[model samples]
Target: MIKPKHNYTGKPTAYLDHNILNYFLRHPETSAFEKIFEEQQVVYSDETLREIKRSKGKENDFLNKLKKLNAMHFKIFVDENHQSTNDAIISDADPFEQYARLCEQLHIIDKIYTATNNTLRKFHGDKSLPSIEELDQQQSSDFIMILEELMQKKSNTDTLTSEQLTKLNNYISRTLQHQKTIQELSTKMMLNYQRDDNASMINTYRAKVGIGPLELNNVKGPKIIEKIWSLHKDLDGYKGRNFSIEDFLGINYIPSNLNGCIPTSSKIISAYNVLNVIGYFNDSDLKLNRRFTSATSDANHVALASFADTLYSSDIGMIKKGRAIYEFLDVRTKIITINVIDNRPL
Candidate 1:
């Protein structure tokens, strides 16, 4: 697996989602986050800057706070030299390559199984594996077969060398940890917004448009959920046209920052395919209204955070979706909300 270069101090690196940054800026009295920022290695992506620019009044103020925090900034684009534009920040070309490469290097087999099993349980209860038709329809037949075969091989531990088995065990352990984290986050989200559908949807919709929370009643929840699902279903036929790993790596794009941490095109592409199987875009309960913005800034933020140790966001939708993607992709980054930090003891 590709391991990220780490600082010698071993402090965890964090990525602050735009909404969280906004919260910090608006509520300076929330010194809890300020303390956390001081203690952790916080980072921001070009996407965050773009989001800040949307509110001209806050752009400079946020940037100044970041400077004060000594936060690191990185470009998520495949080409480091790419101009900082909203369009560039939300483009899939670089993120596809970056994630595909990370997947290739991490040898993320166990996580793939965990993600597949979770997805299967969610969509097709009691099915241990996806049917051939389902896999074929998702364009993941070959990928699933490879994972099944690998899992079979894993069961025969006697055949593996000591080193290989150790590595396999590590991957399995990490995957289990990711699954646990997902469950915990899901539970927390459920508890926090159980009776507030409007709060949940508004937080989710914030990624698309900066809107305040609307007072949606329980009566509207089912309809909104159905509408979101319908949107997903309607887009199924367009999967082939969506950006792929080959599309990114074929261009030989690599981010300019972080000392040229790059992965092979094939591995990066494989990671991208694995995410597709896990249904990052389609299956998650988090509603992503792709129609609102041409640039999927929310997804891009999550993708960039895959490189960090933690991702902080107030948007319930991004937190849910980000956690799903990170867990499925075997990205170790923790997806959290501002509340988690606020509740932490100083």
Candidate 2:
């Protein structure tokens, strides 16, 4: 329970990653965090919750800390007219309650998935290739209904523990196996992204971008990024993805509408991943788990964290990648990388 000495009406909003939050609660230099946190209005998003679930036994502690710190719940959504809401960042949220609702929704989805699988087996003899889009088109497994409810969460006033708020996710997930395609449902998906022996990833990338091959030691920094964005260049984007950094870089404006918001988030995530794949700054543990799942979640953190006034993290790789992405996108959020000064308990 620490408070700032100065009166403040418009404290800067800070989005804290798990490492920074854990540093505050556990590091011997905990008082430093209290002072800094008190001056900034901290917030949490589903990404924060997603990361906390990995702590296993410590989930309650983080949730309690977030609640005690009065961290707002942050989410963005488009409206009926496809316009995003301004009140996306909610101040009165309880992290504990939100976690429970999220968990319950997942559990319900697990159960519903079993039922859906059985139904699929009965009709298609367990050998059918199912696509989520088809189910939505046919309105099977309540896909359409759940999608409607998902979009209606802004007006949802029911207690989260109640049937309406949480089950919507269950219906949606059980409907689609967490929105999986045949690639995930039917087979063990392999990430065979490493190029052939003659063509290394770095060399392959350079060739695509029209740069001559060089040792891994060469090709880096802001200039390479600029070269990737140049229209005259062939590999103007990551492996020639049909869009270059030119498509998103230099966009300084934060979108108020979701039509603008989703693309912006996606661009940030793509740029963050590009840095990792290119090995521009492979500086922390975040890069060790480079699978689609873990990397996507971490990249998403960078995307969501951009909306905050400041993003605080102890992950050096994330800090480096996020800084590069934000600078290129012209996002104004400040990035702070903290390390443990005193590992001893307070």
TM-score of each candidate structure, all chains considered together: 0.40, 0.59
Residue-level lDDT tens digits of model 1 in 201-314: 223323332222221112132233233223333233223445343232222223222344343322233333233222333233323222122124565677667766788877
**Top lDDT prediction, candidate number:** 2
Q: Considering every candidate listed, which one attains the maximal TM-score?
A: 2
All candidates: CA RMSD (Å): 18.3, 9.9
The lDDT of each candidate is 0.46, 0.56
| Residue 73 miss distance in model 2 (angstroms) | 1.3
Q: Model 1, residue 107: what's the lDDT? A: 48
TM-score of 2: 0.59
